[model samples]
Target: MAKIVVLGAGLGGVIAAFEIRKSVRPEDDVTVINENAFYQFVPSNPWVLVGWRDREDIIVDLIKPMKKRHIELVVGKAERVEPDQKRVRLTDGREIGYDYLVIATGPELAFNEIEGLGPKGFTQSVCHIDHAVQAHTAFEAFCQDPGPVIVGAVQGASCFGPAYETLMIIETELRRRRIRDRVPMTYVTSEPYIGHLGLDGVGDTKSLLESELRERHIKWITNARVIRAAPGMMTVEELAEDGSVKQLHELPMKFSMMLPAFRGVDAVRDIEGLSNPRGFILTDKHQRNPKFPEIFGIGVCIAIPPIGKTPVPVGVPKTGFMIESMVTATAENLGQILRGEAPSHEATWNAICLADFGDKGVAFVAQPQIPPRNVNWSGSGGWVHTAKVGFEKYFIGKVKAGKSETFYENAVLGLIKTKKIKAH
Candidate 1:
């Protein structure tokens, strides 16, 4: 019997373990390793920062679910990956052997890339539950004495959705508290434009987001590179299309939330031929490392190049739907290998995103996440907000039930023509 190990228990890893259990032989051993015992819904982090949701409200204890599914769970951070020996070393000095390994550790937040940034620094973050809780506390303090606010993603940052959602959500809360008029808000982003979103403007996202920002009286500086951030002050350099600095400004702010760039986790960072220079897992179309065929990667931990060139580096985002697709394909391929058959499954890698902005939101779908695609669509309304809420409930429920796919969820994705895997 093959021993299959899935790393990280975030959205992709948890679902992957469940799918692998369903596809592999009954005797096959499936184990999941994660640093945390609880599965937190990352999409709801923006809500948590605004006091709309609490930390406990969005997390599920993984122990009960893993026990119910008969999957082994190890709560420890991976220290190193011995690809040649097919073993993973945990921080506790225990080594786990596996016949196959799935790497879904997600990105390691690169806050040190910039000075005085991140939760430990001057800026706030909503990327993780802990960060969101801290941001919530900062927001509470800021509300008592509102001032200028800075919100956007830093250069080389790929995850733009949370930056946008957190910005708008903070705005909504300020208005609710009747202190919006007392606060001046500015958006600073690395994207060449407001809605490039690292996918080169998804179906008029440029126009829609620009309109929303204008209606809300929020000013913005595109192609911005944050030089440094100090307490209550951030220096930004606005660049022109030709890569020349157009202007530099020292913006004062009582609160800030700038998303940092991401890199591969420590365990896989120095593994030659397995990761890119940025430390993201290098995988082929089948999500398997060409050098280490026994290893498969999914989620934000995998490297995807930027769609095109911009003044500042902006990596493409791995949305939830796209990551789920990768998880399904990886599980299927691993199952084929266990049966001594050649793997022949590929993930669609399609992008379907719902960015909630408090009362209203924007949703987009790109058939092939990398442009020049068959379908590209986007829309905005209150329904998107409602749909996002429903998604949170449904996804968290799935994690607790130890189920990967559901008929209703599949039907809805079918209506949108999205699939987790495509046989070729």
Candidate 2:
């Protein structure tokens, strides 16, 4: 039996592990390693920040469920990946060897790249539950005072949806708290426009997002390159459409939440020839690390160039379905490897995004996550928000129950193409 080690227990990692277990024989040893035993529902983080949801509501301990799946769970931070040795070194001084490795360590919060911007300094981030907890605390304190609020994603940063979601949720929370009049809100972003969203404005995203912001009376500044951030101010350089830097503007705020640029988690960061300059794992269409055939990466951990650039530059979005598609492809490849067959990687864009706007939300579905898709569609309503919540609930339950087949079927459903299945 081949020993397999899966790093991280995030959405991608957990899904990959479950699907892999389902495909491989029962006697094969499959192990999952992560710093935390619980799996966090990242999409629900904004709600948690606004007091709409508690920390406990979004956190799930993986030990009980993983044990039921007969998967070994190692709860500790992975310190190093000695790929040449085919082993992973843990913080507790344990080494786990594997015939194959799945790198799903996810992204690292590089707030330090911006001067005076981080969890300890000027702003708050909803990237993690702990950060959101701190943000909620700071937000409550800010509410008592009532002042200007600045929220946006930093330059060279992808994952723009969360930033937009947080801004709207905060605005909604303030209105619900009866403090809307006390807060002057501004939505500043690295994107050239309101709806670039890393995919160069999906479907009607540009018009839809802009209309929502205008309706909410929220001021906006786009194509902003944040140079510095402090307790009361942020300095940014506006960019011209030709990719030239424009004048720098210093803006002040009572509370700020800026999404930092994302990089690959540490395990692959310093590895030679494995990751790019930005610290994202360089993978082929199959999500396999180009230099290391036996190693694969999924989700935000892998490197994908921007579809296009605006004034501030837009990065790619790795929505749940997209990541699951990568995971599904990886699992299938691993199954082939276990059978002594050559493996091939093939991933096509199939994305579904639900962007919540407080009381209501927008739902988008695109076949090729980039531009010029086959199934390009979008809708807006309160029911979409309800659907998002319902999907989250159903997803978490299914994951915890280790229902891999059900999850895979639900993920691809009608999207998987039979023609795409070709042997290597």
Candidate 3:
């Protein structure tokens, strides 16, 4: 019997385990390894920072669900990956052998790359639930003494949506509290433009976001590099098209949230031929590692180059829908291999994102997440905000129910003509 091991219990890993179990033979052993036994809905983190959600609202216990599926659950941090031996070594000195391995450890927040950044430093973060909780505590203190607010993504950061959403959500909250006028909000981003989002401004997103910020009286500095952050202050260097620093600003703030750059986790970083320079798993189009075919990578752990060159580094985002497609493709291909057939399936890598701003929001659909695609559409309204809330409830329920892909979910994707897995 083949033993399939899925690492990390984030969105991708959890869904992958369920999907793989559905596709693999019953005799095959399926196991999921995670540092914690609970799954946190990462997308709701921004809401948590603004006091819209609590810890219990987004955290899901995986013990009962995994047990129902008969999937082995190991709670421990991964220390090393031995691809040659087809085994993963846990931090506690235990090894789990696997016929196939799926790495979904997600990105390691590179906060140390910048001086005085991250929760341990001066700035706050909403990347994780714990960070969001910390940020919320800081926000409470900030509200008592309102000052300038700085929010955006640092250089080399790929996930820009959360940064944008957090900024707007904070604005919405402050306005609701009648304290927005006291807080001078400033958006500093590594993106070349306001809405580049590393995909180069999907469907006039530049115009839509620019107008929205302007309407809300939010100022912005694009092509920005955050050199350092200090208590109640941050230093930003705005870059020109020629890659030179056009100007530097010492912005003062009582609250700040800057998304940090991402790299592969420590367990896989030093593994040669398995990861890129940043430690992200290097996979072919089929989500299979070129050097180690038995290994697959999905979500933020996979290496995806920047969409195009910019004045500052901006990595591409691996959105929820795109990662879901990868999970489907990986399951299909692995199932084919088990059935004595050639593995042949590819994920569409389509991106369907909902970026809520508390009251109103933006929704975008890219047929292919990368630029130069077939369909690139973006729209904004209160409906998006409602839809986002509904989506959160639906997704969390699905995870609780141990259902990876539902007929309604598949039917919706089918209606959009975007198959989860397609022929390569």
| Candidate number with greatest lDDT | 3
Model 1 pairs in collision: none
TM-scores, one per candidate: 0.96, 0.94, 0.96
lDDT of each: 0.90, 0.83, 0.91
Superior by lDDT: candidate 2 or candidate 3: 3
Model 2 TM-score (2 dp): 0.94
Better of 2 and 3 by TM-score: 3
Tell me how many residue pairs clash in candidate 2.
1
Write down the TM-score for model 1. 0.96
lDDT of 3 by residue, 328-374 (tens): 99998889988899888998888877889999988777778887777
Q: Return whichever of 1 and 2 wins on lDDT.
A: 1
Model 2 misplaced stretches (Cα beyond 4 Å):
405-424
Candidate 3 positional error at 2, Å: 0.2
